[model samples]
Structures are given as structure tokens and as C-alpha cells.
Target: MTLEQNPALAPVSDLPGPQAWRDIGVVCPFDMALDHELWRWMPDGVNLIFTRTPYYDQPVGLDMAEEISDHGEIQDAVRSVMAISPAVVAYACTSGSFVHGVQGARNLSKAMVSAGAPAAVTTSEGLLMALDALGVTRVAVATPYLAELTDRLTSFLEQGGKSVVSHEGLGLDRDIWKVPYATTCELIRQADRPDAEVIFVSCTNLPTYDLIARMEQELGKPVITANQVTAWGALRLMGREAVGPHQALLQATKG
Candidate 1:
């Protein structure tokens, strides 16, 4: 059945106008964590800036909350990047955004727009939206975050109606920029679950465009990561194609 037959598919008409190549500033933790997967998942010609954090890695254990506090000054720091002409700004922290929950992401987005950029923030909350939009209720999660960070992510997902049947975290202390691509892919593979309808790799810093398709094929489910969902959210807000991976979930959903 066409979208014409299903009212739920009404996105084509009400979709915002004039979708085009535009820059989206990322208010990120640790500047160097902004990897190539972001640009690769983007449709084309999207511009970005990675505002680095001094800690440069996922906070270990109890320091996670302190790390979130550390990023509190990000709005002002990222404003400098957003000031350059990017149409949207995403505060790309899965944990920090989740610590605020859905309402928090909305408030953060409102703050960005109010700041003269007319922006949107993609946090762990946005990932909830992405999963909901994809029609998933059961998810498998993989991340570079330690257990505490992953637990926060777990709380956000469970509260949002997505159930995690299988979850794993690398518990790494190294900066994401130094995370080898092979290890990233392996973590996804190890984390893949048989009963999951959706797979979420929760770190924008971890490169994943190349793994989404492969992992999905192996697990037979939709695969998404922090960067992919954030970029897709930003694109849709700006009226762009939420396109597919070579083995992409968005691509697979297209008619």
C-alpha cells in the first residue's frame, strides 16, 4: 500500500519545505570524537564543527555525572560554531541528553533556537524518537560508554517504551578518536541479539555507517547509531531525505 493508503505515511506532504544541502553544527563532547561516519551518513554537502572537550574520553564510573556537568558550558561554546551559518545545531551527547530525558532535549533545542540559530538538539532523547519513528519496541544496544553511562541510556530507553533485551558496553577509557574501527564493528557484532527488532550503537564518536548494513543483515533488524540518528533527525527537521544505508534501515523502509 502506498502512503496515500496509509495516513501514517502522510510525511511526504507535511514535510517541511526547501530541503537542501546545509551545515549543521554539532555541540559535541571531545571535538576529536567527531568522526567521518557523520559526513558519510549525511546526504551530501553538510558542514560540521566538532567542539572538543578537555576530558577527551567517556567518563569512567562515578565521574559520568561530573562529566555531564563539565559539558554544561557547551551552549556558549557551540554558539560560536552555530554562528557560522549552520541551520541546525545538535548537542550530540547520548548520556548528557538522556540525563535530561525527552523534555530536556526539547528545552535544549528551544534554547538553541532562541539563541538566534533556530536549531534542534539530538541527544539520547532523539534516539528514542528515531526508534519510535522506525516502529521499534525491542532494541539491542551497543556502546563505548561504561556501564554507568550505558545504564543511563538504558533508563532513557526503557522509560521511552523501548525495551533492551541485550546490551553491551566497551567500558573503554580511551578517547573515541583512538578507537579502532575494527573494534567498533566487533562490538556491534557481539552486541547483536536474535530477538531484537532494532539495534542501537550509542556513541556519536564511534564510527558506524559501514557497520549498520552489515550488522543489520546479521541480526535481521534495523540498525542505528548515535551519529546516524542525530544526522537523520537534523536532516528531517531541515527537510532533507532521511535516506538509507547501503544496508540501511531508512533505505530499507523506502518504497
Candidate 2:
């Protein structure tokens, strides 16, 4: 007998709830391994549908960033999730958005919109929004990128009219998700300075959900991360708040 005809099976119309109250489409890099981290910022009653750029054998670098950020690749990724009708689509890769500088990041957002996303945001754009929301200028940065890649981020920040007071990097080309909390904490410590107003932990794949509040307490300054800001920006486009209890960026958005 067909499953639909089985007496033990419930009818499709008997399902209890809608797929979600709201949905956000996310386009991530092929090597993104920490999907749970992105979900941590999603509020209840909302859902995240994800897609990825085509896999590349090259390690994470300027070349890799360029490849993933290609308008064609991003447009295709965005199209894959258009069926969900998400309120907004986010390109959740920092280097990909920022590697080509300020205009490049904006182009990435436009690409998503052109591909049928109602709205779009990129991690680099989210970082800028987080900074503007907090009304701070001097920033410190921590990353798991090589010196060259780190410099590109600095340039991107400067192009957006923010000064990079100090920065540190782990110089890894791949497996940024594998960096431990202690090591990440140390990197933040090394990157922080009295002159800097906020500390930004770059890279969505590098976990930071559990560390934002603790690090803010330890450093006596607000801390922001890639995934945190990406979710925040995307949710904000939909007139919703991201779900972070003590995250400084989320708290700033509260009425």
C-alpha cells in the first residue's frame, strides 16, 4: 500500500504549524562548517534556509574570496533560496564581501536582490551597520586570516570611514572553524587596545556566540562577531531583532 493510504500515517493537512512565521535565506561559503552558530542568532518562530557557493579546492585567501564573491556565484546561490520567499537573504561571508572593498560589498547585496531576494545583506555590510548603530568609530579586529587578507579587511573598514586601531590574525588559510575558544579569546586580547572603542571578531566560521557577553565583560568594551552581525542585519531588514541575550549589538537595537 502507498504511504498516503496507510492507516497509521497522518494526512499532510494534519500538520500542526506553518513552516515558519518568517524565513531568512542565507548563502554561505562551501567550506562553512558551523551552521549551528548562525542559528544561535535566529529568534523563535523564524527559520533560516541555507545555500552554499560551489566548492573550490583552493584554500581561503584573496583568490578564494574573489571566487566565492563572484556576482555569478552569489547570484546563483541567492536564486537557490528564492523559493522560500525569505524576507531577506544574507551572504554570510566576510572576506568575500569585503575583499574588493566598499563598492564590492554593495554590489554583492545588489546581486542578491537582482537574483530575486526581497532584500540582501552581507557580513561586511552588517559589521558597518553594527558600528553605525553603536555610534563608534575606532575599532580593533581579530581574525583567522593571513596578514594580506587582514589588510584587505582593514582597507574595507577604512573605506567605510572607520579607523582600525589595532588588528591581529592567526594566519590560517583553511579550517577557521577549528580555532578553539581559548585561542580566539587570546587573539581578541592581543587585538584590543585602550584607543579602540569595539573589538570585532571576524569570520563567521569562527564560533563566537558563547563568547560575546563574556568577552565584553572581560574587556569592558562591546564585542561583535561575523555571524552575529550577519543575523542581526538580515533580521533587522525584516523588522525583527536577533536572539542574543547579552550580545552588545542586539542590546543596542532594543527599543
lDDT score of residue 106 within candidate 2 = 97
lDDT of 1 by residue, 68-172 (tens): 434336666556776577887777766657765556656666666665567676656568767778888998888887787778777778878778888898997
Off by over 4 Å in 1: 1-21, 52-72, 242-244, 252-255
Off by over 4 Å in 2: 1-16
Q: TM-score: which candidate is best? A: 2
Model 2 poorest 10 in a row by lDDT: 11-20
Per-residue accuracy of model 2 over 1-255 as CA lDDT, tens digit each: 876688456677776555547999999999999889999888887798999999999988999999999899889888889988888999999999999999999988998999999999999999999999999999999999999889999999999999999999999999899999999999999999999999999998899899999999999999999999999999999988898878788888886
Task: Tally clashes: model 1.
Answer: 4
lDDT of 1 at 74: 63
Q: Estimate each model's TM-score.
A: 0.79, 0.93
Superposed Cα deviation of residue 156, candidate 2 (Å) = 0.3
